[model samples]
Target: MRTIPLITVSLLALAVLAAAGCNRQPTPTTGGEAKAPPAAATEAPRLDEHSYAEPDKVKTKDIALELNVDFDKKELSGSATYTLDWLDPKWGKLVLDTRDISIDKVVGERADGNWRDLTYVLAPTPDKILGTKLTIAAPERNKRIRITYHTSPNASGLQWLTPEMTEGKKTPFMFSQSQQIHARSWVPLQDTTMVRFTYTAHVTSPKDVMVLMSADNDPKAVRDGDYSFTMPQAIPSYLLAIAAGDLVFKPTGPRSGVWAEPAMAPKAANEFSDTEKMMETAEKLYGPYRWGRYDILVLPPSFPYGGMENPRLTFATPTAITGDKSLVSLIAHELSHSWSGNLVTFARARDAWLNEGFTTYVEMRIVEDLYGKERADMEKIVARNELKKEFTDANRDLQPLAVKEGVLKDPDDNLTGTVYTKGAWFAEFLENRFGREAFDAFLRGYFDHFAFQSITTEQFADYAKANLLDKYPGKVTQAEFDAWLHEPGIPATAPQVTSARFDAVDAVRKAYLDAGTLPTAATTSKWTTYEYVHFIEGLPEVMKPEQLAQIDGVFHFTGTPNGEIAQRWYPLAVRSGYTQANPAIAEFLTRIGRRKLIMPTYSALVKTPQGLQMAEQVFAKAKPGYHPITSGSVAQVIADAKSGKTQ
Candidate 1:
């Protein structure tokens, strides 16, 4: 998953959560504040708290899936046939995770290839976050089990968009965002990241639409109702994705391309044209691009996250196609995940830094290589500032890069800047301390050693100690290294990153703020999205109406096509009472469902009486088009404001 820059969605939530008084206890500090020793060289990992499946007992090895997409009912009826590996013969049951789903029956394959009905039970969940547990009585001799089920109309992982919600407005669209344990809502299996399984899928959709999955995709396949897919490589359930729509494909390179609605096919193809170059850059940094064909599927505006790194085909938000390729960092971030996340995975959500931090570090390296050091540096600075703003007293316990075993109440809680930005800073600290060449070699070795494996933070720590820390003893002490991991905030020794471009932009902003001086075309015309965001964010929290009008008139920020600029300028417009931008804000909010860009605008709007009315009115009309995740998040913001939790 790639988090957007400028401002994070969680930070906007934190702003509202502040008034509620976050009375939670903070995690214990390790290195800087308290000189504590690190854990023993290699400690055994605990079972995933977020998963009900006992992988040590019996794990899934592969799956054969058959499903029918019903647009009218807005449900997916499917049977997932699993090939199991009984790790311990004594274990007589196979447990899986599920949420808001209907199970017709489960059967086991006998020696003669005949299926025998198996006794199964659905256990109620104590914590809804983990979902329901499905346990099947499996005999030691049984190797194959099939589950016939249908997803709920309101499955959390799925977004069934009506025809009017799509770009073409002629055919309905359906897509899946299963990251962070949402897979259980659509497919019953071990939803934890601890286990991996290969899968083959047979899906039937509308004859007018096409289907795509994370598995191998035939770009030139016919747009028939039936589609078949095979994922030869083993992947966790979270990586299993599906989409069907009035889609068309255009190749950007021999191995790279995009799929989008006909109206967006050519534009999106042009926007992400550098995807092949990104793949080459990532391969040079790490190992080969293990996933066969690197393609991207650009979903409609209602897609939640910026991008999801689903093995072969990446699922992208329409917001990424800015016509200028200014937001391709999201692409780089997702592409690098082909190495850090898709190849080597995190065993649990608490150790998410292992996947995200490494990917952020590599993504920046790719950005620096493809764009320039200046662009990458500017991104780092913006991310750092956003992380600082996000870290509040209410969320102090959640600030550490390495979360405690039971700290995560919901998987979405892990989607904070701490895991993404703080983790990246830790990687950069290592790179700055040890030479880049040495660090690069260490990372290359790390990816190669752990390919196709799900590991815990302890495992990565052990590997790093043996390869990097122990190899260069005095360069980084064990205690200091522990600080970066166990500590609640950025370490004191973190490298101070600078960007000359941002400094120049700051000068222009300073003049404008101090003396109301208009920026000249020479400086303003060269500004990129990051530079514009920096300038807008640096403005005073409260400005005069005339000043707001002056900036909007000068820069045409009211309805800028650039999503990044709109996210920043809209909030400033709300805070400064720039009424001229209200219509544009409504259109932007209803059209773009990306949580990061829209949540902050809602957060700003909910603070005032008039703005709150506008927010509620707009959200009432827009909620139907949003994914469950996005709608739920924005609903909380509105509810919090109504209850005075946002005061």
Candidate 2:
């Protein structure tokens, strides 16, 4: 396990102190006289300690970006000019985060509005995760600073693809995924969630390609190799996203649409036909959608995460185009983030549960409202089972939802089933205890109060106590809240989730287990993807290869096009030594790059010597198509196996 360096900790402490001092309220003057304070004195709450930026000294209010996209060099070369709002000019310097970026020059505006070259220093590398700190000398009354820089070949946030990797095999593609601290690799800024700034950009791309961003986007207009954008809403740096490729768009509704490669745009539009309804449902539940239009861009199969909740436009995976709308729950999940994550963000990755868990709860509600209660209940039951399996693995490194204070070194480690599943369970518990109407009102009010702000777990608790618990004293107790939020593992009061459809599937699984016989196809002819997943997951862990063959012959799980079903079944086939499923497993591993499917299948393959060799061979061919985040995770699994460590 890795830890933060001592020097980084010291710098972070200084930044926290500076922020606290800057935020202190002004004192009353003597003889009943009062002095007006600077506008920056009433600073937004600084709750994030994961960043090295001292925003109290000098803060950025807006950003102006000018960049050129060179696919041949696989680089984004540009200059970022930031409008600064200073609090304490005597600090004399500004620090920003950078990784794998080449700086050409740093210049600042003087008090008399003249640009002057400024001396800057890139601090020594601290750790692979934290990157380096770029410090620039500042003039006494400087209001703007510009850094001319370009990204390196190994920038983690970027993924440059050849024509062969794209759906339309005629043009190349380039996309960015910059969440959870990867934004520093491509852009130098105060890369922290505590800071929010509006931005405008001028992007110059190839004549044949179209560019899109997380800002106001126009799909029908064609530009002469140059484009401009504006995002009026102040957003965190992680939501900064850009993509360029041979793309086309089709409107799904008045205020919603879908974008994809020209070859897949129509199919994607049809698959996501209900996106407008989802937005409307979410707004009715919470509040109005603050972002102007809600649209989705379906990337190629190599996208690592299920969905990234970029403010106006979401970056999605092609796996969600399952034709049957069974997988649109993922879209609902991302749309829920418009309220939970995009509007009100968690201060740091350590408090990710506040973003993910609340979104999960909201996702289920929206699904139930549009679809049905049975579908929603089935999803929750599956999630609960997955959480139990994670607990049974008993890995101390993978901590529970409410992890201990200061024990976390890397925020990515908190992205676990505990945070997502058990966190949703906590919300569900509250809803069940206090009644749906009351819980809904409370959530709407919570989002209203903290809109466009970064928050912490402790602050959330305080607000909940004052708003809900204090008003109705006998509904729930403080100890119960503490146990749910601070204690490890699921509390004893976890809400019970049940689904009749899953219960029927479980009975079929039990019948097969007890009698050692395969069921007829007629028994499951009317099942949906969720029912099939439940049936597959309920299979015995150590079934004989012959039994697996019998099951496959009847259900044809190996050739299923649905990524979720194949992901669950392939790992089971690998563990059972079913040689017949090898080709399908190889194709699945190589073609799809989602971490949820890739990690489990590869981890299962590396358990034996023969399986380890197969895993390596498949990975060699698939490595080029995978995003950096996916490849990094798969490499670690192989390394652990080589070191005789169980994954």
The top-ranked prediction according to lDDT is 1
lDDT of 2 by residue, 1-647 (tens): 00111121224333332333222222222222323334476544433455667776677789899999899999999999999888785666677888888888778787788887655556444457767666665634468999889998678888888899998888889888989888888899998887889999999999898899999998675946799999999999899999889988899999899989988999899989999999999999899999998889999888898999998899999998888899999999999999998999987777788889999999999999999999999999888888777775455444455565565676666746767887888899889888999999999999999999988887888998998889778888998888888767788988887888888888888887898667787889888999999999898776799988888888899978888898889889989999899999999899998888778889899998888989999999998999888888899888889999965
Q: Write the per-residue lDDT of candidate 1 for residues 93-159, one digit (tens) a residue.
A: 6778888888887788988889876655554332467777665656543799998899998899999
| TM-scores for the candidates | 0.92, 0.91
lDDT by candidate, in order shown: 0.86, 0.82
Residue pairs with colliding backbones in model 1 are none
Off by over 4 Å in 2: 1-49, 392-400
Ten-residue stretch with the least lDDT total in model 1: 19-28
Task: Give the CA lDDT, 0 to 100, for residue 607 in model 2.
Answer: 94
What's the residue-level lDDT of 210 in candidate 2? 89
